[model samples]
Target: MKVSVVTLLQESNVENFNSGLEVLKKQTLGFDNMELIVIDQAESKSEEQIIELAQLAKKANVRVQHDNSLKVEELRGKYISFFDFNYSTSPHLYKNLCQEMDKHSVDFVSANLITSIREDRNLAGAEEVIGAGVHAMTGLKLINKESLLKMAGENKIELSDSFIELLNVNFYLRPFTFNYVNKQFYRNKFTFNESYVNNSISHIRYIAEHVDLSASKKSVSLMKVQLLKHLTFLLDKNMFTDNLSEEEQAAAYDVLRNFLGLVSKKEIQSNDLDGYTPLFNMVNKKLDEEATHYIKLLRSKRHWYEQTNKYKQYFEKNPYDLEESLSWKLTKPLRLFNKWSIEVKQWFYKVFLLTLAAIWKPLTFNRKIWLVGEREDQAEDNGYFFFKHCRENYPKEKVYYIISKDSPHLYKVKKLGNVIYHSSLKHQLYMLVADTYISAWTFDECSYPAPKEKFIKMFGKQLAKKFTICLQHGVIIHNISPYLHKDRYNQNLIISSSEYEKKIIQNTLGYSDQEVAVTGLARFDNLHELSVKKQILIMPTWRRHLFKINKSNFLKSDYYKA
Candidate 1:
């Protein structure tokens, strides 16, 4: 019964391991067959975090290795049990794992599939796919490490890139014991890549942080660590499909609807938990008529199609052009601000239309140039909103929504009436023109470009009487002008829907006490009021120029010397 413990060190879950360590120590003191190995990979010996592990080792007489990982080749002859920071299983997780040998010869034990808590034989032993746990708190017991080493060779504990598909299917039926102890600890954790896709309203915060709804290619591509992480929980095969017996259609319906409830964007139309579902699972379940219907509904708006086509067109242009243009090279702030600007313009365009009253407005002058922005997602926008609003609210006034040159409805929009159009984000004179410059959430306004002449014209003397209204879109105040800057966007008419945001502006951005207004956000206000009384909030802050520092620390930064 000799047992060896292996753990991935550098995780911040000291509390999680605290309880498990206590349990392991108790088990070790009573049983002479255990040897615990806690790898401390902390960069420096900060006693605050890891020194206690050494003390635990001393108290339990277990070996604790610092700053080194076990070589899989060297671990060959040992019976090993590995856990990440998340080892909150019942002690029986280990005790029951040892019971697998009684069933038959076993190679390894996995922490994915679990027995039914209901204890019904009909449901018991049924395989439950636990994709989220893959590579996360991966706990495995090797009945024969020598056999694994021979099988894996130098492959070690690292999962091969190709094998990720298997894990993606929830540790596909590998030869391991399934412990029915899976639980989701991270709240509001999404199962889908919400941060990867933009203009997708699945989750507002992630959409604000990760995806851009306007770009065709958006930000939805896969990350290596993300792709690697969700796999290890996979079994050797997908045995759960077998449970659909007699209810294949029903099972698919459940899975897809279950999935639909997961991946949908954050619109007020349907289930708003789109960011939490797995797109691959939706595809797997899409074989049925109802599932297909849901997927089509999931892709629902033209936004999805437009974005898809845009990405298709981009890649189609040269086939391999992205190797040079990807934004991963920039830090988070730059990448996010770039996304925020594009979407704010598109948001200004799309949301304005739904609220406008009239249908057409004449273009009084060619001077009114409409410049389409860089929202490649191609999500549809409503030039009509601005036009109709202008005509109905203030008739005889010329108004136009600038659209990208590649906009599909360029001709149709032109044919609508006297509306004018432009194709690039570089359009000027509009922000500099007329008595007042009004925008819902145009990026060209909120973000200060004062240092550059192009951006400065926005705030130039000609635009002095200009009243630029910020229709706060995304939540999170990081992209707004820096706090140190004396002036922020035309501060006279600043408005926001979030009270928290109003507070944030006053506290962080240093808005003049009288100039700011807490007018509700328009795009989501109706949705918030009518749907579930949920109004999205958007206050902001920039990226940590150095490391992960607390907001409190940031607030205290002006006060702290260090």
Candidate 2:
């Protein structure tokens, strides 16, 4: 009963707080020893409206006060608990927390926050008080004011910061036991706003100040990893998408720079970073100031194209080091093995396959031997549809679809005829004689038995005579020029589903007019007669954290579980 529930109120959440007052009136804890303090911060409300709201709170025996500062000492209750109008809580949360606090004699009792009932699969609570710094600050917690004041005094943190101060108290002050009440008393409904930019800065500062680099190395690294992931999300979701002002963008930049400065380069260079490696590496290399200026230009409506060109010029002047990239280092072994395998395959083809070329040469002489494939192992995507088209329409064209014999989708390809096993002698010979190579991915798919570079080098004139068509897996929306540019993948022709997509490919990917064809996706051919169903389909994009991870590790990822 000696619990004082404190909540901050503003004009935006006035109605929400009014509803919350109704819930407080129905609390199991009697109002005689309990008090609800609503600190009003909304400036638009008139004096009459304030009085009416105070009278309404008075009906529930709650006190409404207008204050610019928080005076923790003025609280009459032995414990102070922070609550928000954005969340829904049970009537017995206060009573249950107080009971646990009394029984365990703990300084604070942390309750579970089930944001989504479905996401609370791992209901096993925190095993250490350090975990309180994470879950406790965001969710429901009842703190003994005596212990809080003592901790704040010893740690030299003011109570005015509220949740941030409480977070510091949780981390810095030792022997402050936090008992976790294994019950879902709260459900989160808070949406992230620009305030998140400032709040994240505060959390980053707290970690930098409190987490010892040498003593808690693992904790420090793990915290940095988590913060970097958050910064990446904030960069993509809020900074780029939200119409933030220049000052807000600058603040977001500072948050990123502060994180980069906190963690070492080795740490930054080791993680996958969820497609944020280039941005992080660029900032880490002291190009932060220049990059910040150019990045701001990208957010501007009027100066986007002009500023983007300047940004690209700057990037070209200072390109990222591939040897220093995380992906490059991680794939070094695979790349080396691939190179060695290519050398062996080319040697065998030159020594053995050329001897049989006399007989195979007769079959492909002035003929249209079309070779088709999707991936090295699978037969799906645009390749399958286009191959199906070729087999049904051009029966005498000698069309063959390449697929690994071990593929699960091999049956799908075999159902249509002329299936060639990938990496076989016949597949390698087919690549050499084929007049046109069609693929769903890159041009490299056509040269699977040997490396694309090796094949081009071994038979430059022959490759020139032959043509490679890219039936792209999907529309080109993102700037993936580094992978598809003319300097990277040498496809004779690139198919596009739309003129806009073709323009993006031409302008961003450095392709010429003759190279890109405005052909809609082949999969759409089947959609003409397809019936609409009374169902919804949700297709989330791929998560970078799961990339290159083994099946076992991927199955255990938080992204997978979520």
Candidate 3:
């Protein structure tokens, strides 16, 4: 099997690059089965400097791509290995990793690494390790290219430097066997600096976002290890200086708050110190008074879960168990009732629409169209685009927009001339008379049965025809089965960006190729005309459970502060 040794060259240090390439050449033999892919990302390097580096790579028989745009589909390799420019590997590392993987029939294998950082001195062990905690991507490891690609997905072209560690953790969390070759195969010459604290904390926040505490035990263990590692690093005065900036200190506080908020009080109590009492003591002695105060607060604040009977009853029944609680069992009926109520309400609405369709006159071809979006509270997405297009191109076309009762964009949609804005509840008459229906989401709000209703709505008569056009909100990243519910699949035309997305929609939603239109998203038009600004826009989606508990204080969340 071929191995692609991928190295990201972020800095324009030709000397370092040459040295790293030379080390790779000297350490590993038989370049026939190996391909070196150098990703050059030094923006400051001129054309001449880039050409020089490319020439060096060409001499070494290595392929070079200028920039960090890595499309895994374009790469040719059975196994992909990552290396840092500052690190040197053992000659037999690749061979050893391959042997270990084959011996154990594992997905990937990583070996212990020797780093310049003093904290990592005791990290290397003689015994073979097999778990997610081995930090697979950090050191020299041969990963199954297919598995890594599937986990990372197509959109993740390149990972930010701060997030690489989190990527490794996410990869290891997958349900695959991982093995550690009980030997130091790589040496890291780079030393940890002041940014280490911030990076480590960012990683903790990443864990909080990605990891499901209720799902995987291995993930939980890894989270604990990462937390402890960050804490230990903060406590280590030898590594960390006392001159932390105000911003850094504030960031540390936010990280601690988020960390405490994510984990349970019992988990903290159970794993506190964990035989690292010396490190704990050092933290108390060396850490600043403000840092110590945050730590104290974290230790004292009761986890929200602890107050719930769902947690208390679980432990009361079995202290060491990781199963669902009696409280969850007791609330099952209530949960089912809520779900049943929503479905029943949807059914009643559909029935009511069908009843109205039976008596209502066929739609009149008057160039009138109705538009709606995913959320009732906004006039955005494809629906908004279609509305804008109609106003500019087809001014004679009578357009009506459906807005929720409390929609914030109500005034904005009403300001458009010759456009009628109707509350969602009072739009049934408009739906019956409208020539066509355009929407960014499913037509669940206006239940119009296809084939029958399609004939009535489009041809202005009882002739067989279709009317509704579905302008999907975004590109499909994962399986689209969840969103293809109710009347979504019954739409006459489903707008898609590319052939790949069309295929995904076809396969997932069981839509015929003819029914799906490969047109670009309407909102993305004239994107290049927009002026660039030096501002960050954060759009966070709401979670039901969190919102239900702390709806008022959501804006004050540590996540938002960070």
Candidate 4:
């Protein structure tokens, strides 16, 4: 069978490619008849780089071609595989994979081995947390061509649904059915094994099994209220508690839930909006019909205080003009419409026109919008919506991210079509360029930006009415102060995972009830139990004030009580 291998090549440096090519030559174990397609992963269009690739393919005795031919859909076939050049493969990796392909009916296939790197060490599939870029699927695999054409044509490079679930939780590979060559083979995360010996493995595994690859069976994660409904059922009904590993399933969430109860035991005192992002996210999550009634009352009073005393006083004489400056201050309601004055009437006319333009925004999807990526490495894995869901959901709009220079995704981000990368954008530049926007509480877990600046920039005095959504990423444990501090601006949507969090976010961020939802991260499904006998760990994270597990025996007196 002919295998089509598509890999991005990385040379330590192109003009000096001898050493890297030497490594590839020695990789093949002297095999033949394989077709190799190389896409230069470098940004430079240097002559020497192209030459080096051609020469290396010749020495390996494999057919080589440069691919810039068509879009992803235009490229298709059975038995196709991809990876960057830095990936290493064992002598029989692909051959064994080929033999295994002969054994099962599948769509696409990847390596049994995934590694997390920190410095020189390989953290072999330890917990295999989903988002780190350090993974290199074994460079060898035989894929089913029909599946390749199917997924590629649809522009889905990875799973169809549950992409967020994949990111937020740890997964394990399926055994035998997965056919691993050795124990503890790792997948991607920039981890260094540090002191682990050759055979040591994390007690947990990721992705214990592969579900149906067909699109019909995909798209299975739930909204927040739905997940909570299910979770409440599971815990209240004692459904999985009978299983031997049931303790592990509850280890991540239980401790956090209890710890919050413990912390609440203390007095409610005011402090400068400290590390409260997670706390607010949790409270925001609890903002349902029941929770909203009480929370809205508190938010109303806070709003009155801010408006009567804070916001009106603060931005009254500011250089920039807006209906209201964003702050933990009073809000200006759109309902106070006095359109009779010629000036007010003109602004109303402009607002009327902008609303019409918004109705047809789809035609201008190519216009760029901000996809607020977390700048910290730890939070980078928080499941970027642009790459999976956002881009997929709004396929027409161009997405841009302003991330820190050290972000691992800089190169990969460029590869994603219509995505622009920026860093340290000036306030002026941000006002001029950004359209719709999304943001999180910072790595420092403080407040989100008051979005009106974006509105004023995009729509002038008439805020662009951009559809902004602020969803929390992890198990939240801090309080509802800084993020909800009377100094932040309210957003269009203050998304959370629980009703309690919804209340906190609305009270803190000052967005109203219409602004929030508890849609669970589409990624949280990892915590769920599949229909089959799959022994996997879908461990979501917890904030410091939430919970910490033993990492070994999850239930050993430290799981929930701690």
**What is the Cα-based lDDT of residue 492 in candidate 3?**
77
User: Mind giving the per-residue lDDT tens digits that candidate 2 earns over 1-562?
Assistant: 3988777776545546655665666678765667677777777766666776768566554777666445666677888887766557787878888888889887787677664233333333332323323443345678889876765553433333334444543432345567666564676554456555455556655655554344355555655555566566566542333344545555666667778777776666666553455566666665654554444443454367778899999999989998999999999999999999988987876757656655786956757788888887777689999988887898777899988889999988888899988878788777777878888986464536645575567666656677888999887876676777888787889999999999999998888999999989987798887898899868465455656543445556786677
Error of 1 at 556 (Å): 19
**Candidate 1 off by > 4 Å:** 28-32, 43-49, 56-61, 72-78, 112-143, 154-562
lDDT of 3 by residue, 69-187 (tens): 67776667778777777776777777777677667776777766653223233332212121223343345667888777776676647655545555565545556567656564577
The alpha-carbon lDDT assigned to residue 338 of candidate 3 equals: 100
Model 2, CA-based lDDT:
0.68
What is candidate 1's lDDT per residue for 343-397, written digit by digit as tens? 6875664334322311221232433333221122221222233333454565455
Residues 305-365, candidate 4: write the lDDT tens digits: 8888776776775557454457412433323333346457657644665665565455555
**lDDT, model 1, position 115:** 26
lDDT for 326 in candidate 3 is: 83
Q: Which regions of candidate 3 fall more than 4 Å away from where they truly are?
A: 11-16, 43-52, 57-61, 115-138, 154-156, 212-215, 238-241, 272-289, 292-562
**Highest TM-score, which number?**
2
Predictions in order: lDDT: 0.41, 0.68, 0.59, 0.41
Residue 368 in candidate 2 has what lDDT?
A: 70
Per-model TM-score versus the true fold: 0.31, 0.45, 0.43, 0.27
Model 4 / residue 331 / CA error / Å: 77
> So what's the TM-score on candidate 3?
0.43
